[model samples]
Target: MIMVNRFSRLIGTLIDRAAALQHIASQCILCAAPGQKGLDLCLPCQLDLPALTQCCQQCALPLFDHKAYCGQCLLSTPAYQRVEAPWLYQPPIAQLISRFKYSRQYSIGKVLSNIAARRYASAYIDQKLPDLIVPIPLHWSRQTIRGFNQSEHLARYYSHHFNIPMKRFLKRCRPTAAQQMLTADQRRSNMKGAFQMCGDVAGKLVAVVDDVMTTGTTVSEASQCLLKAGATEVHIWCLARTE
Candidate 1:
């Protein structure tokens, strides 16, 4: 029985390792070079991706001054207490996001989610993890066309990696115009009252997940909804941010 148990454990380990390798891309998605460290991107390409090293604590806008918060954030803090985005909305990363979002490229989305999971793990090393993960919802009309919400896909990855529960707690109250097409001021107004909280988040620390944050109006509106629903604190997490 002891020998049989040992054999079983060894087989399980081998199977797990094999499954992991199967998921690792054999060629880089961008350069067709060998994939790096199980990612679909080569090391050179990965290093070339825009990283948001310094940014506002509240908004994740790239920072130039040696200050913790940006001038805009200092002037008027956002509703969410914090925001984290690992990459800037630039080439390669931007292209990858476009493919993942519009082209329905699951492989690209997997790579993006993996990158986010790694960064977020280190980011909260000394901070408390949120009590719940919430994905920004798509209105049913739009979701019917897209077939999936990209934010929900990323949120699921975070929940699994961090061993935290994820909930679709917010509902898109109305289908708003595409944010990218609107001016900054128009974008802010477009997201107004766009989200409604559907669950009891009273006193809970909630992390809201999205694909990209441009003017941050969408996330701000979502955060406001959660806060009004009694959430103690709200944090925004996204794959990329536009500086």
Candidate 2:
């Protein structure tokens, strides 16, 4: 018992020292300069990143002028009540996402997710946090091929930051063509019957998490499934949105 306790303490000390060394040695992932505030980014690059300042309250589409909701959202309300994205899909943000999503660089993903969570924490100060965080699911076959789900990682960060439970409430029932290859109308049609609820969400406020939103069709479909399962409300939370 004495030896075991001593070994554990030694391991803990080593881990603490390693973390401190990492902080001191950190460099910006984008510029390879010294990182700031323990982020894998410098202050200048962080400030210069494309921010989603003015956008629709409902869909989060970039707006030319300040507006409560977009024109399309006003005509056809989506299943989700609102969307919140911290960045526009441009520049270093897009490059970071591509690395995280395709290159299997989880360190990059963690950096992006951390920045997004901090921004979201401030944005939701006046609003109530959701009861659950649900990640947009990938089809099993695709997930198997990819070896992981990017949205799930994002959801995990939000879950920890907000102290909300993360649940796999929705699952992709069928595989569909990649949304990136489809037109807006085709994307909408392709997602039909794509998601199915796996657990009861009756009267629960669910925040659906995704890496990015383009046409917003994927999240909309997932939200519809949660609503059909009797969720009281659904909100979309993503890292970035295409302008």
Show where candidate 1 strays beyond 4 Å.
1-25
**TM-score, prediction 2:** 0.90
Model 2: per-residue lDDT, tens digit, 64-88?
A: 8888889989999988998989999
TM-score of each: 0.90, 0.90
Against the true structure, candidate 1 reaches a TM-score of 0.90
Candidate 1 clash pair list: none
Q: Model 1: how large is the Cα RMSD against the reference?
A: 2.6
Compute the lDDT of residue 21 as modeled in candidate 2: 85
Query: Candidate 2 at residue 34, lDDT?
Result: 84
